[model samples]
Target chain A: MKTVAGIDIGNSTTEVCIGAFDDRGKLNFLSSASTRTTGTKGTPDNVRGIRTALEAAVQKTGTPRVYPEILLLNEAAPVIGDTAMETITETIIMESSMIGHNPSTPAGVGQAVGEIIGIEHLSQAIQGRDYIVTVPERISYEAAAELLNAVQGMVSVTGAILQRDEAVLVYNRLRRKIPILDEVAKLSQIPEHKQAAVEVALPGQTIHMLSNPYGIATLLNLDAEETRQVMPIAKSLIGKRSAVVIKTPGGNVRENVLPAGEIYISGDSEQTVSIDAGAESIMAAVHEAGTVRDIAGQENSNVGHMLRRIKGGMKNVSGQAESSIRITDILAVDTLAPVQISGALAGETCMEKAVGVAAMVKTSQLPMREIADRLQAELGIEVRVAGVEAVMASMGAMTTPGTKLPLAILDMGGGSTDAALVTEEGRVAVTHQAGAGELVTMLIQTELGLHSRITAERIKRYPLAKVESLFHIRLESGEIRFFEEPLSPRFFGSVVLLEPEEMVRIEEDLTLEQIVDVRRGAKKKVFITNALRALEIVAPEHNLRRVPNVVLVGGSAEDFEIPEMLLEELANYRVLCGRGNIRRTEGPRNAVATGLVMSWWSE
Target chain B: MQTNKPAVHLYTVDETLPAIREICAGMEEEGVPWKILRMDGTARGLAYRAATDSVLESGIGLTAGEVALQMRKVAEDRPLFVFADPTAEQYRMIGANAARAVKKKRFVTVQAG
Candidate 1:
């Protein structure tokens, strides 16, 4: 009887499966475990994670620190995924000419155009001059309201900008109601003595005049050139509740098309495409190149620097020569980078077009024997480097209930998306593509303008909900969840990720549907797109319809929505697909590890 | 002056509540109309009874020692929020959130500390 433990080291995690052949020659998998991987896969550093995962699996089998008779390690996928974003367009505001925000409690309604004046300067104002009072944070609501009331008869104060959260307090006290914008942090930045248009939409509505370029031109009395310059500012103000546009004739908003430069794909033919051409054209060029042998970028350019950085990164990781590394696949996605408007008083962000690229890197080979020898020496056990990752995954996938010959398996991991197919005659075909979980996170981060990558990652991994009230939440599926106790007030009126234990608030101001739409759109862009590409390469004669059943096995396959999404997408091609349940027990996990052990006995 | 508009009613036994300004500002920020009046009674009992009598079906009974947010539809014994010895900030949140209940919007978190 041989007790064997199969270990699969991945970019993000390490998984272990312990199995033993009984005296009757029947195999039984005692337990499976997973832990965060210590370092890059296919390295000697993986031994630490391997030991942790093996110990966890051993604990599950009611044992304490028992090394298996033999350890089977998967030949980790050779592909390395690196993602970078290149800004194609930048929004440059010339001066403090715009203010756009959805302050939770902006007061009053309708639009007003006036000369921007400080509250203290109101005492010096003359009659017939329309003015907007800028109230700094130091001015109390009562004091500001008293001043506005005192000047109402003398000066035509059409609007008010408040630095503190007192727009409603001042608005409620006013005799003649004027549109008031509050929570303006940088009140001093609103260009002094300049003509500005301020608009506050009615509750539950967005500002129309300030959001439209032509409307802004009408309010500020701008000519054609000035109107054209404010288009990007107006674009950034869309869907905002309140906005202010100061007319500076010198206030130039330039939509500069940054020189992102071109990438060269060397394969069947040398193909060159500029990253500034956006994702569609870049992807077309990459696809046309047909099996990229190597990719290079122009010197001193954004794409060029990105390529060199990733190549340098790969060299550091695998200790391989930079010239030998090849970029096999590139998933280029068009995304909006939230570039902060330079001179805006409010911290407003305009969506600028950016190319987000995740490319797959691989060397001719990885030194798996070196890692195997180190692990064996440390554990004092026989450790063998197992079969190719995809083939072993296919063997483990067969342990799933009701699975038969001629099966295709898709392994979606953190770094790469891989697909493998095994025919009835045992002929295996495999394909590895770039862009998986990390790419999806990049898309979410760029699209949502979330400040932190951790926040973006949480949004990618969890479902979202809008905290509607103290006790209830409206989920992404429009299902209402009412809690028995009062939820935290900080989460109220914001979108939150529905984690298992607690509600984590998302800081972005978006509707639940919009956030879910972005999340799923990102998933579809990366996973669904890569799914089709992978299936085509591994399917019979590169035809998806010829493929039979598909079993999804990977860390990403266990994602709450990915498998269901793939099943729906693959169904269009009439392909049967579902998340794999290895040994009818482990759900879409430990496949590569379990496969390693099974393949060892089979051969 | 005609006070016929629908508004959240704030009732207090003593006329000298220092937290009234904070509470009023909180309600005002949400663009909700409100009225504060002197009522001689326990905070909970007055808020419970006043909730059904107010035009907006939302009422807050405030005192130096306690505060309560009551809704007309909910049972009088089980008010929405009843805090003992709430700070000024808590009173403000109670006022804003009670108005929010009337407006059918999400309530702000009432910090106990």
Candidate 2:
């Protein structure tokens, strides 16, 4: 019979299962066993745990057999750069202020310079001459009214340029409504004279006067020469909001060019490539250089060697590229080139830094090859590791049952909680967060001050019991019976310690009732708190309402009160909650291992 | 004693008299032999007695290990089959311990049909 072994290396335990094909091609479960996992669960170092679990299963089955024909193992899924990347992205989005890009031409004519003030100065400034007024963002309608009242007779404020969102606020504040232009990027630059005819363009609309030469001539009431003079202003205002073209009496705008050079590539194969083609495209060509496509459409060895040769040549030339730039020396990272790097000098080598320092110097930046070499030496791992979440999701999908395709699984282990939702089409979305069983255990241990983890686990698992009197006591299992003799003085009036051997006397001061309450309260705080946190993190995008069924199979799920508590807590969602039948049908534990074997049948 | 017809009787303790009489009277109409085994404290003593008797009578065709396993199976099937007036704490502790034991034992079907 062809037998298959499935192994799951978990944080606290390793579970294994053996299955053989019966005469009818049905999977017959032979045996299953669990052993405490040695080393980290998901690491290659967990091989020892896998070996121990396999031995235990073999012993239980009492079958002296060689390694099964096929062995299926759950690939270790590790969190790589997700949380850090998320945090960095969020920080950048929040802190960024100015995001400027030069528009080809801006419309509007003439310069308007004046003291920037609120709408109150508008009436006074509009009496005879033009003036510019600034509207601060976030000021409400009512406040703008009072400010206008206070500045009734101030200097003439002919026109106003408001910040984003301030346009609506100021307009609402005015008793009489005026056309407001929103999202004025260069509001501070508006010149004084053109303020009246300068209709401010709103956020959604384009620069009107700039788009129409006839409109600019009519609004500014300019002669042919004046119209000509204002033509540049109109052109500059083409796409700008709140920008003033100061009639720089003698000012002219000209384009400046920074020097750029071609990156030359030389290899044993005499292949020339352009740096302007983009790094990814270049790398794709480099990777496929010498490979030839077979009838099966797969690259053969000849092409593979060519690609390797190019990669090797590229690594050697990277140093030369970096030195020629005369900024920071570059090296190619062995593991994950093209994604990350390490450098002694900051600005020039990094893309993010390059953007920041572009105004200072025009230094030539080297190709990615140099950066990859330096990263390989420093990080020990590859420069550009594959996305950890993506890898785990693919591996998890491969090991899970095909019939239950598109299923979501939460690996609630000790160090981290990993959740993967696989689609029927084979796409997988995965997320990972810190805090799970270990965190709950830590909470219990800290709260109870339990000396042993065994004791803490026991406390977490059980309800409570209290000795009512010498003659009788109440058990949490809903049992009450008369003692053959009077209860021992040690057990009376306090919660009895049920540890094997070493009976310690309970404190006589506390009543049995008080002890029961304390234990229940403590367990509730620790277990429930951790469970909710784990659930929230695992399914963050969707509410619990969407997750209709939750199959809990973990070390913590074995706790007596935990399952009941979870059932009650998740009752609102009407989710079907219970232990996996895999353990019941075969034996306790080894569900993941069994699933792995079953996955082979599916494939 | 010489008659071929079966006979039925009901037994009751002072504390459980009302409940016992209600159940016995209900069964008596159907002409079934019903008895209430009562004890002073919790129902645990009665359950223990019942379990012990059931184990002995059922032990005729099974090994000692099989007898114990069967007893546990019966207890799981009808939890009230082995009733105990346990305290809140003992209820929590023992229930949890028993569950842990069952889980550790890897019982295929904890509650026997």
Among all candidates shown, the one with the greatest DockQ:
1
Report how far residue B98 has shifted in candidate 1, in Å.
Answer: 5.1
* Per-residue C-alpha lDDT of model 1 across residues A205-280, encoded as one tens digit per residue: 8999998999998998988987887898788889899988888767756678888878999988889999999999
Judge the docking of candidate 1 as incorrect, acceptable, medium or high: acceptable
The regions of model 1 sitting more than 4 angstroms off are: A22-25, A62-67, A123-126, A298-306, B1-13, B35-113
TM-score of chain B of each: 0.90, 0.31
Native contact fraction (fnat) of model 1? 0.53
RMSD values for the candidates in order, in angstroms, are 3.9, 29.5
Q: State each candidate's clash count.
A: 1, 57
Candidate 1 per-residue C-alpha lDDT over B14-86 given as tens digits, one digit per residue, 9 for 90 to 100: 7687877777777887778888788887778878866877888888888778888886755666777888887
Model 2, A1-603: lDDT tens digits are: 667777665657878777887656677777788888775334434556666777777776664653455555554342210000000000011111111112211222233334334454455454544455555555443465456545545544434455432443454445434344435454444333332343545444555654354555565454676566554344434544433232333422221121212222233232333323333433343333332111110133222233333333333433334223211100001110111112111001111110000000001222323333443454243332122332333333333233254444545455454556555576655544434444445444433434566554555555455654445566656587566655543344445554455323343233345445545554354344444434543443656555534554556656555566767877766654554345345322455676666556655
lDDT of each: 0.85, 0.40
User: Which lDDT value does model 2 have at A185?
Assistant: 50
What's the DockQ for every one of the candidates?
0.36, 0.01
